[model samples]
Target: MTNGTRTALATALLLAVTAIPTSAVAAPEAAHIEGRLPSGATYLMDVPADWNGTVLLFSHGYRPMGAPNPAQNAPDDTTKALLLDRGYALIGSSYASSGWAVTDAVPDQLATLSVFKDRFGTARRTIAWGQSYGGLVTTAIAERAARRIDGSLAMCGLVHGGVANWNNTLDPVFAVRTLLAPDTDVPLTGFEDQAEATAAAGTLTAAADAAQKTTTGRARLALAAALHNIPVWNDPSQTRPAATDWEAQQANQFPALRGLIQLPAFSWRQEAETRAGGNMSWNTGVDYARLLGQSSVRKEVTELYKKAGLSLGKDLATLNKAPRISADASAMAWMSRTSAFTGKLTKPQLDIHTTGDALVPVQTESALKRAVTAAGSAPMLRQAYTDNAGHCTFSPAEQLSALHTLEDRLTTGRWTGTDPDSLNSRAAKADPTTPARYVPYRPAPYPRPYDLAHPADGR
Candidate 1:
C-alpha cells in the first residue's frame, strides 16, 4: 500500500529454507528459496529433493493497487504443496507492484527464471503457468519468450489480451453510467486516484442494486452484462441457476458484476492508467446496436427488454446519442503495444476454463482461440473446460491434470488425454487425497469482443 512496501516487492534477495506446511497437504522434501531481484521484485522458489528438471514459473493474477505483494509459488497455499510434492521445481515473484501491472509482471517473472538458474542451476525445461491476469501474462511470455520457454498452462485466464480485457469492460460500465445512473459522476475512463475508483465502484454497485428491482432496470442490467459477456451465476460455491431463477441469478451475480464491469475492473483503472500514462480505454466508435446484436447474450437481452415492455432499440439509441468516450492516441498506442496479444506462440500452450467464470468470462477462451488461429499457431494450443462458476475455482485435481496435459505435450510432441472425458478421467485419477471435479462443457465465443475483432481499434 505504501510506496516503501510497494517498492520492496521488486527487490529479489531470497534465501533457502526447508519446506514448511501451509495447508492441509503435507510439506514435501524441498528447499524453499526466498529472495528479491535488483528491482525489488521479491521471489519464492521450491526445489524438491528429487527435482523433475522442469520448473513452473507461476505468474499470479491482478492484485488491487494497495494490496500487499507477496511471493507466490502457487495459486493457493494448497497448490504450493501439490506443485512441490509432485517433484516440480517452482518459482514466482511479487512482481514489483500489482493492479494490472502486466508490463512489470511479465519481465519481472521472466527475470525470476534467470535468478533461479543462477542460484539453483538451469532447468531442463521451463513451463509458464498462471491464472486470471497471470494467464494473460503467461500467454504474452509464451509469445515473446518463445524458444526459451517450453510450454504454458493458463487457468481461468484473461488471454483475451491486456487492454483488450479492460477496454471492453468499458462497454458495460458505459451502459451503467448512461442508462442506469447518468447523474453519478463515475469516471469510466480516467481516475484521479485509487479512492476515486473505489468510491465510483460503491456508487455503481448502489445503482445496480436499485435498478435490479424494476423491469427496465433489470433489462438495462441485462444489457450491460451481455455487452461484457458476464455470466449470471457468479457465486463461487453455487451451481448455475435455473432459467426461471432469473431473480436469484441477478442478485447473486450483481456484486461481482459491478465490481468487474461497472467499476473499472475492480478499480484497477488508477494503476492501469498510471502504467499506460493516460486513458488507454475508449468506446468512441462502438456502435451499441451492432454490439448488442453481436452479443452472446443478445437473445436474453431481447427477451428481457421485450418482457419489460421496452424497446431494446430505444436504449441502444440512447447509448448512440450520448456523447461517446475517446482515448488519448499516445495512451491507445501504449496499451495496444503492451496489453494486446499478437498470438505469435512458439511453443505448445493449454488454456483451462470454467464455463461460468464471472470475472474473466469463459468467452475470453474463444477470443484467444481466434487470435491463435489468426497467427497460424493453432497447432500449438489446446483448451479444456469445466462446468463451474466463479473465477479460478479449480480443484487441485483439475489443476494438476492440466499441468500434466501441458507436460505431456512437451514430452511426447503430441497431445493425449486432453478431451473432456479423458481430462475428467485424468482429473479424477489425479491426486488420491486431493479429489477431482471436472465436468465437460463448451463455452460460446464472447459476443461483445471488439478487441478480438479489431486488435488495433481501441474498444
Candidate 2:
C-alpha cells in the first residue's frame, strides 16, 4: 500500500476507535463567565460555585481565533469544570490573536484573574495551568506574577525563549538538508548560492504563507507537505522512523512534489520553520521595543537562516565556533534569566509529559527539568510521563490520576510521592513489545538549603 493509503487507513481506524463510546466520565457543573477585560478585549472564564481559596487559571495550546464554544474541541471548559468540581475556581481567556500572538494571552489571563476576584472574591492562592503554547504563557505569567500566583503547573510547555524548542530535538544537519533539498538524499553538499536557495526557499515560504490562511485540517496537512517536503499521507503501518531516516526522505523529495501530496503532514514542518523563522523574529522585535529581555540569539539565528535560505549545518558550525557567545550562551542565558520565576512559585507543581509524544518530544521535557533543577527547587517539582502519542490525551485513569495530583497540591501544597515506575507504566503498556527506556530525573544538588526556601535570591 502507498504511504498515503496507510495514513488514511490509520486515520480512519483512529476515528473509528474514538467513536466507540466507553463510559463517559461525568463532568462537573460550573458557571461560565464571559466579559470584556479592562482593556476592552472580550474573554471567557469557567467559574465553579464551590469556593476554594485556589483559582485554577488555564491557558490553552494553539487554537484558531475567537472564544471557545461547546462545539469546539477545547479542553478549557472540561479542565475548568474538573478543577471547579474539585473545589478550585477556573478562569481563562480568549487572547487577542492566534498563531504566535499567544504572548498577548498573558495580560488577558491577568485580566481574567482580576474579574474572578471581583465576582467571587480574591483567591487566596492562584495556580496557573497551561499546556503547550499555554505552557509558554504560563512560564511568562509565572515570571511576572510570581508573587501573585502561589504555584504553577506547566504541562508540555515551551520553557526556552527565542528558539523553537522542538528544533533542538532533531540533528541540525538533518534540519538543513530537509529545508534546502527536500527531494535529494545528500549530505550537507555545502551551502547553495544564497540568491538561488532563497528563491527556492521562497516557493516553500509561499506555500507556508498559503497554509496559514487555511483553517481546515486538510489545508493544514497540505501546508505541511509543501513547506517541509514531508509526506503527510504516509503508510500508517510504517512505525515512527528514526530522525535520520525522516530527514533523508525530506531531503530527497522536492518541495514542489512533496507539496502536491494530498495530505498535510508536511504542514507541521512549515509551521515549525515559520515559527522558528518569521514569527519568533517578529516577537523579539515587539518584546525588545518594550525593553523586555531579548529572546535567545541561537533561536534568532536558526530562524534567520530559514528566512534567508541559509544552511543550518554550516550556520550552526559557524556560530558554535564564533568567539562571541551567540550560539550556546544565548540559550543558556535565556534559561538562566527565566530561572528566577521558578523560585517564586509557592504552590505545588506537576508537569506531565508523554514519553513518546511525537509533536513535542521527550527531550523538551528534559530541557525543562534541567532548567527547574538548575534553579534549585527540584524536589518541589513533580513530573509524570505517559507513553502516549500526540499531545496531552491520556486514558481515564491517567487523566483522573493527574487531576487528583493537581488537586492534592492545590489543597495541601504538597505533591504525592513520585512513583517513577508507576508514573511511566501507562506509556509502557501502550508499547509492551518495544524496549523503550525511561529517562530518570537527575538534579544538581543545591549548595545551601536556603536556595529551596528562597528561589528569588540569586544563587
Candidate 3:
C-alpha cells in the first residue's frame, strides 16, 4: 500500500492496509467501478463478486470550504475491504460541494444512489453510513430519505442539527471573548468571508492559549467547555483522564478548546451561515449559571475555581448579564427548514460515538436520542459508544461492528445483543485485526441553543 500505488483504471486506489484482508475472501470476482456524475461530482462503486444486493452509501465529513471535494466510496480503506470481502456493495460521492454540506449532501447522496441504481440496477436493500459531519448527512437521509434507505449507521456524528451544534461550539468561544478577552475585538459571528473568519479564529485561539496558562483563565475555559459539553480527554493516542489528572486533563483539553475556536467558531459557523442565508444560532436569554451546574465536569470546574480562589458564580453571573449573540430571524428560519433532523425515522439507525470525542462530542448521541424519541421513532434507533478520545477515531473493528449491529436489527426487526458486552463480543468475532472497544456510556444532555422547534435543536 504505497501512496503511489495505482490500478489499470484511472486513479483507482488499491488499498495497502493492515486491517483489510490480504486477498479477497474466497476469491470473489468484484467489480470495481469509478465515474463522475453529470454534476461534476466524482464517485466510486464496488459490487462484490457475491452481489448480496445490499449497498452501503458512505458520506464523508467536512472538508475546508474551498478544498476540492474528494470522492469517497467508503468509510475507510480497511472498512471498504472488509465490506467488499463480506459481499456488500459500496457507493458514495464527493458531494457537489464541501464544508457545512448537510444542505447539499442530503440531495447529492440521494442523487448518487439514483445514479448507482441506473448503473447497477435495483438493490434489495441500502444502508447509509458516515462519520463526523457526514454522520449528520447520514441522519438526514435516514429521516428524509426513508423510502430509499433501509438503515443508517452514524459514527461520531454531529447529529444534533447545524444550529445547535454550531451554537454549542460557540459557547467556549463566547466565554473566552466575554470573560477573558472582552476587549480583544474578535468577531464572534457574522463573518463576511473566509479572511475575516480566519483572522477571528487566530485572535480567539491566541486568547484561549494565553488564558489557559492561569487558574482563573482555566476555570473560564472549563466553564465554556462545559456549556458545549466538550470532553476533557481529546487526544486519541492518550488514555482517559483519571480523576487525579485534573490539571493533566485541562492541559489536554486546551487544544481541543482551541480547536473549537479555530474550526467551529471561525470556519464552520460561517459556512453554516452561508447555508442558512444568515445566522441560525443565538444565545439570547441563555442562563450560564444553570448550564454550568448541569455540566458533567461541574465538580472539576468548581475544584479549579476553588484552587484559584475565583468565584465561579461571579463568572456565571457576568455571562448572564452580558449581551448575548443572536441569530438573524431569516437565517434561523432557513436553518430550521434545511439543516435539521426531525427524527421521524422510517428505518432503523445505529449511531456510534466516542466518549471523549472533542470535535463532535459524545453528547451528540444524547441529542439525537431525544430527537428520535420526540419523533416517536425511539424504538427504531439504537446507540453504541467506545471509550476513546478524538473525533471519528474508531478502529476498523468498531466501524464494521456498528454496521453489523444495524444489519442485525434490520434482519430481526428487533435489536439483538446491543449492550457493551454483547457488542464487544460481536466485534471481536468479526474483525481479527483489532480488538473491540465498545463501552456502556451515557453522555450529558446538550447545552446550547437550549430549545428549538426540532428535537435536535438541543441535547
Q: Which prediction has the highest lDDT against the true structure?
A: 3
Q: Quote the positional error of residue 456 for candidate 2 in Å.
A: 21
Candidate 3 lDDT by residue in tens digits, 1-459: 554553433244333333468575467477877787777777878898898989999999889787878889787788788888898999998987888766678887898899889978899989999988899899889877889999999989888877677677767788889988888778788999878999999987888888888988888888777777777787876667788667776777777888778887888788878777877777886788887877877787888888888988888888988888888888877776666667788889998988888888787777788777876888988999998878888888888888888888999899987899888888887897886899978888777532243544423
Candidate 3 off by > 4 Å: 1-29, 449-459
* Tens-digit per-residue lDDT, 1-459, candidate 2: 999999999999999989977667455466777777655546666556566667777777765333352211124444344445666666777666554444457787887778878877777877787777777777768766767676677775654432433222212223333333345443121113333333444454444444333332122222222222122213222344344343322222223233322111222223433333321111111111111011111233333335445464553343234222122333323333432234333345677665433334334544455556676656666776655444555443454355456666666766663465554453344334333333454322211111222343223
- The C-alpha stretches of model 1 lying farther than 4 A from their native spots are 1-29, 261-263, 433-440, 448-459
Q: TM-score: which is higher, 1 or 3?
A: 3
For model 3, what is the alpha-carbon lDDT of residue 19?
45
Cα error, residue 290 of model 2, in Å, equals: 36
